[model samples]
Target chain A: MATELPSNIKSSDVLTDQTSSKWLPPGLALQKVDERIMTLNVGPQHPGSGHMRLIVQIDGDYIVACDPDPGYVHRGEEKMAEYRNYITNIPHLERPVIHDSCNVLYPYVLGVEELLGIEVPERAKYVRVIASELNRCIYIMYWLAIYGIFLGHSTMFMWPAGDRELLIDLMEKMTGARVTHAHFVPGGVRNDLPPNFEEVCLRQVAYFEKRIKEYAAVFYDNPILIARTQDTGVLSRQDAIRLGTTGSVLRASGVDYDLRQKEPYDVYEELDIHSNVMKEGDSYARSKIPWLDMMESCNIIRQALQKMPKSGSVRVKLKPNPKGKGLNTVYKRVESGRGSLGCYIVSDGKPEPYRVKLSVPSFRNLIALPYLLKGEKLGNMPSVYWSLNYWPVEADR
Target chain B: MIGTATGIIRALNSGIKHLAIKRFTLRYPEEKLKFVGDGYQFDPSTGVGIAGLKGRHLLFHDHCTGCQLCSIACEGVAEAIAMVKVPEEHKQNKKAIMPQIDYGKCVFCGLCVDACPFYALYMTNDYELSSFSKEGLIYTPAQLQVKPYVAQDSEIIITSRGATHG
Candidate 1:
């Protein structure tokens, strides 16, 4: 929703004559006013909208009508899938949600493997679950990190990224690359752990638990953050679904539709998911969901570590004729850090995929912004939007 | 009912508190932060990629086994990485593996790494590959080979520990 609309929009609450009610476009139920006001266009470049620009017609600071403009960074990602081979897309797709690379690419690999009928090994499943949960922690860490600034809890923002680096180091040890870990493949993973991975992982998990409390001390305890986020931008369960909000936002709204619970991918089914259901769908609840989710992510990682087989092939043996038996195509949708990352892959009896289309999560969630921001003050915009953690690249991709 | 003075005071108090507390900013050039282990690899002049560092294309020399299989398996997108075999001297028994990287046209995909049986080449994180002249990007065998691998003093540990250093 990164539309850079012009500031030429008439701001006044679209004041109508005393006699009749004419057509006023879909923003607010046109506010009853007398004089016309100047409409201010906030972002494609503005701070509040992140990467999105809203055509916000405002009277003073209160918004009259808001329209979100999108497709600024659309690099034809789905179209690129048609051109790229099956495995090559792991890197291409990973770039969008760079923080949550494993989660984004998990379903893509799952979808492709399901199509090729290549059963990914058990050790690989454990690896995938661990990697995905670690990615979630990193992503949520950034979410709280930046949102901390919006709420004026500066340390919360910095602390999470610094701590998240520990997990990033762990990922680096597992897969050679840090952010873009090309660990997930059609059959299984690229390689196995480089020894002492289990010990290092447990230590980082405990360290994260210690660091997450500092988040409470800095941000949660601070009254400014509490005031700004607690009840601001509230969405009831019905409103949230109608707005198509998912992930922490939906969890905040108390809908509790975590894909980890619903369509349990990898080792998620075996591990008990901790759903942080906040009755209040406010920014505070939304912000808190990820912190709690971070703990759950650690728990899942621990469960995965315990559940992992003693010694087996991390990567399934690469068959000479990979596209053997049949070339059945299937689409698999799994929840990523952003939201639902679904891959629709088609195979046509060749080594290369006939077509691949990725239904990214951020793009879906970006549409929910204008609905939430109807009557809210301009000041609370950064806090609300920051909590959303809209990866513009992921949305535009 | 929020006053302008109150807002300003709150903001000022917060800013002062942040400064009073441990300043999170790294003072990047002056007081550098310690890089945990290995930072993303790179060189100044030539942007040659190392292992798994998704560069535009890979270039292999006399070490390449004459299996043009890499180019053959390159699907959908035209084979950006080509294994052109030019047999110079068979004295050492390995064929002259002359690899050309057309940076003008390459996706920087490490497919060749996955494809190569010999594990002859890989990608590094040197992605500052901008050039005024187009000719600089068209990498030759000697250009790509790890002979005089532009050895750098990254000032990593030194820069971070410099203030404390004697």
Candidate 2:
């Protein structure tokens, strides 16, 4: 992902030859000697764009290029790791995608295990897969709920969130924390699923299936959406790979590259990963990608549950020492809701990691905006952006 | 060509049916929407009425710690929250405290309610709170404490604020 340029690039570099020099202008004409059109700064605080800011270069009504303004939501996560203990970093990493905390941080914990050469028990791996996939569902549902808000579809926002309450309740019972599940330490998960976990999960799955169909009936097959999204913001296969994209964004462009299926992490190798690929590469494809992935996530959780392995310990139960674990660094990438959520830890083999960098999918998908927006109309910009499912907290981190 | 015609005709039929389904919009004020049981639970604390329901400032002044954390969480352009200290010598263990909310400045993001640690706030469903004076708008801790006698949120006290949340 790091091809060129420094680790730190100044904000002044975001401005291009196309900043309008005016806020209200609609279009710009091009000529050999013409000045670049004006650029608009939309949020660290603005509607449509959530949490982080966007630096958009507009040539008249169309966007010439759009660059993400990261750091408002940075939270100094990498910097914070320098001082915090390994256990302490769990809380901080959880904050990045709090809803998918287990998925984002579980791999980091597993990496620490790899360095220490500690084997996570069988029962714990089964439970971790369930929790992580369920976390993916939680985040994808949240994206759908919020995307409905972006599309001005109020009922869509309310329906998914209301049903999501059941899943949240189930997760809350197991982990204690409603949103942040700081379970899954170096050796294993916090504990086994409580009684009636299977029954409740089955019910939620059934409820989700019905809701998924409803979501499809409302948006998937909706006429107004077809006109707005079909063939809009199309990206070819080559550009997608060259740009370092993954998950649904990569799969939507016919890459067939899923870490769960290809890399075979966890129980995913034993189970068949069902993926629905589309080569259209349009905004509609991007919008529909989450729906496909959500169902796939459900399938993964179901398999992880069915093939429950016999167990040992949940945690490796390390002896505490002020001296720490010592220096060892490991980088682990896991498929998460937004994209490839990679966690890199440089441990001094101490109690705390020397440095931690989270490579979130939102951060990469965010850069894909300018390429998509170049020739699209201003009125259609919101629709294109919503289709991208950009979350500020994940991107900024 | 024949298949495309059937698809268009079916599309038109569904479109008309959808419009008919949505045409049954309730007048809302005259005939309200209903919520099922446990009915509603109105703690003397949390003044927040239900999302679309009607009720005015339900507050808990006795338990308030006056941390001003609510002001920090309010997502708005204005700083509706202000703090004034009672001073050290004035008394109960010489403590210093201040948490004053200016409604004129309050955008009502309910962050204060969430931030209060002690759940001392709520945005009751009272939608009819139109103020003629700027003074009427700035509700102090005292004014925000009690609910109206008539409940002021619904018709005939049949579906009063307390009944829904009780």
Candidate 3:
């Protein structure tokens, strides 16, 4: 779907008045001096804001206008990708979403494999699917943990953080390293499953599922959290579609669109993936969608584990410094923890790509922030903002 | 009012029930978490790496051919592995050079290990690479040859009460 910014609110420059003093910020000045509109910067350093600034203009606790200032953590990831070959780009590209590195690297690996003309084995495909689902759960847990602390729920923070260790332990045994597991490669994964990994994964995942179900009592069903987030920052189904929101945010608004269900990259078609949707479009719905997705992820992982081939090669033997076939462009996207993470590569028959572009979901979902925040009370900002499942580092990258 | 009260009570009950559960935190130094294997190793013949903890780099002087493939691989990624000329004379190693890794820059992605066709390099489960000085962080080929002793036994034991590092 093609989406464009409403011309009325194209830029912060349009919001400024000619009568404003040079020293004042863009959104501060108004035509009428007595309007009592005050501008508040949530932060590049504020507790609620994560590495990005929000320029919020408010009047008597009601927000008049909001602007999200991202790019504090931008490291020119795309530009750096052009310098490195396809294989070396694995470690660097996965940095944006360290928590879901496998999912982030999934599209890049898929795209590279297409360009280099390498066939991934059936076992590798199954392993990739399992790893991806596991990573999705890990990411959603982290997000849920943060969503808890953001809503002044301490127990919510501790439980998910602790419960997440089960999967992280599994990931370490599978890929190595806790957060930035550069496990996914072009031809296939960097390695195969460890000895006796299936039994351990199944045992831990079953336990992990039970643990998360307990969260309903403590975090999700809590009256205080429900009161704070429900009916606050409601995004309509039409608005969600118009804004081109992806992942949980889109699903929260009654759009039954998930890249896994719709696109079915890799072995997703073989596995039974349930795309959860909520009709309500509030902060509560947005927050609840990821938890539901985590449940679905657990199911997907179980099915993938069952379907995987017992014994086969997980990686293809590629020629050293493998170059692209010819001057060609390939775009591949997969449903990541945040949203649909797309990788676009332009290769000119070189080991190093001519261009690499990552269409990150965080950046796309960010467009809804100003739309959702406007006309809402200032106090509900953290709940609404954090509920979007926006990761600042990925957006900035 | 009843719904709200029940919700609050339910949350409180969940919190109280967790008090009996064993502590999840592991006391580091005193108690180190054990890894599954020695380290991450790659088989050049199979073109696949064995899954293990990616920690510090280990060097085998006997296996190193001084081909500089590992160094060349690391150049695009981290430039952590440097081919340094060593004084030791070996029959296989003509130039007496091996990968001297600066752990400070190493992301521990294990690409260099993957690049080593002769199996000269592999990652070990010795991640405690903290040093006071910057010079100490760089492991020479000789320093990498000595395998560090790891005393780790703790594993995550999930029980009915709750999971804990035991």
The TM-score of the first chain in every model comes to 0.87, 0.87, 0.92
lDDT of 1 by residue, A108-208 (tens): 88887777667777887888888888888888887777777666766665667666667776776666566777667788776666566797688767666
Worst 10 residues of 3 chain B by lDDT: B21-30
lDDT of 2 by residue, B29-129 (tens): 56543321111112223221122221244556555566666555442224666655544332321334445556666543333443445655654544345
Residues A6-69 of candidate 2: C-alpha lDDT, one tens digit per residue: 3355536644344443332222322232256767787667443347666776788888767666
Clashes of 3: 0
DockQ for candidate 1, please give it.
Answer: 0.14
Docking class of 2: incorrect
Stretches of candidate 2 exceeding 4 Å from the true structure: A1-38, A46-50, A310-312, A321-326, B1-166
Model 1 gets an lDDT of 0.65
The TM-score values for the models, in the order shown, are 0.77, 0.66, 0.94
Best by lDDT: 3
- The DockQ-derived docking category for candidate 1 is incorrect
Worst 10 residues of 2 chain A by lDDT: A24-33
- Tell me the tens digit of each residue's lDDT in model 1 across B53-150: 34333334544565655554454343555555554654332655555665666555455556655444555444446688888777665566642222
Which candidate would rank higher by DockQ, 2 or 3?
3
